[model samples]
Target: MPELIAPTVRLHAAWLEAHAEWGPGFHEDGFGLIPADEVESAAGFAAWVARLGDESDPAKAAKAGGAACTYRWIVEGERVLGGIALRHGSGEFVQWAGHIGYGIRPSARRRGVATWALGRMLDEARVLGMDQVLLVCAADNLASVKTIERHGGVLEGIRNTKLGPARRYWIKIDLPIT
Candidate 1:
């Protein structure tokens, strides 16, 4: 069974295997990877993992004046499957990209990994006091649409973005009765 875990340096080799499988690009989405991130070296990967951990710290994020984000890697034993991030804030990125973003490795597609990971992130959002969360995906990504819809996401229509036309949806988080 797959489980969510914080990014760790111990899994650098496993992560590199997964990253290579995604091909050459910064499209890994939920891994919090950026164009300038040098994850090829052990030191660079460790720094990147540290950066992700800092980003998840509310105090650090506040000090940095950025969104506090929770990044989780979907893994099974030593194998890395994918990742999901729950971002908190109404910043421009959150507005354009959405509160949550995720990607499952090509080999793990159609196996409910994204769905399960998304569901888990939604729980994280709820714990952070979010009443609803936004999610955007390529307009043509029917798989993502279904995954979002399965979690009760309501379409707010498609819009053209710097990345091209994308479908936006809002998933209302049902707060657990206190």
Candidate 2:
């Protein structure tokens, strides 16, 4: 596998925490697992169980979608090293979470895993009819700042959210559907 686009998966806690590197971020808000399938154990299933829901509202549905998200980030073969989930714009999510969220294991941090994974998610957003998308990260998160920047994200300014302070960005996804 050349150092380019990898695969993503949706996972459970057992699979997430199984690797010592994932730690706390896997279960937080705007949180997700990379190599997404790392969460396949019975414990993982239990953690994910609380998030599954069928909602009528798009916003509500989007929240459920984020919890139920099963996409993975794959590097090389048979590796579900990371994943991303889409949070629909609604209430606080609109002002904060953006249309996508992602994570890669600590072991894989500077390998461009986030940049690669987010690019794929952006492509998916384009497929979903989103022309431009908003992404936010903590003002102190230099890693995410670089990842988003490498993916053509434009800085929009900073804002304080219920979650914390964040630097917001926008990406004009120009993918045309074939």
Candidate 3:
């Protein structure tokens, strides 16, 4: 079984193993990783992890003038499977990037990891009082399209983004019946 947990430096080596599996680039969508983030060294990885936590802090987000985001890694025991992020703000960035982003390691694909992690994040979104969430993926990515649709995502259309054509979807969060 997979579990969703906050980013931690204790999984440094495990994360690198997952990172390497994706090859070179800042394409680990759910990790909030930027090209400038130095995650190769222990100190750097720790700092990056700290920054991820800070991004989740409303106070820090207010100070930074950016969206508050929650990041979680999908893991089974000590092995990192993938990552998922739920953005808690609506703006141009969120509109273009969507409220959620995720990526599974190449080796871990087709095992329902993305589906499971996305469901977990939607639960988190519900807890945060989000009525609905947006998710955008490459139009060519049938796997992601299916995953979004499986979670009750409604098509919002495809648009040409800076990253290219993307299929945008919105999933409504069903509040619990009292």
Q: Which stretches of candidate 2 lie over 4 Å from their true place?
A: 2-14, 17-19, 24-76, 89-91, 175-178
Ranking of models by TM-score: 1, 3, 2
lDDT per prediction? Answer: 0.95, 0.59, 0.95
Tens digits of per-residue lDDT, candidate 2, 131-170, equal 8888888889999999889988999999898767899999
Candidate 1 lDDT, 50-145, residue by residue in tens: 999999999998899887999999999999999999989889999999999999999999999999999999999988889999999999999999
Give candidate 1's TM-score.
0.98
RMSD of each: 0.7, 5.7, 0.8
Candidate 1, residue 76: CA error in Å?
0.8
TM-score of each: 0.98, 0.68, 0.98
Instruction: Predict model 1's lDDT versus the native.
Output: 0.95
Error of 1 at 59 (Å): 0.4
Please give the RMSD of candidate 1 to the true structure: 0.7
* Segments of candidate 1 deviating more than 4 angstroms: none
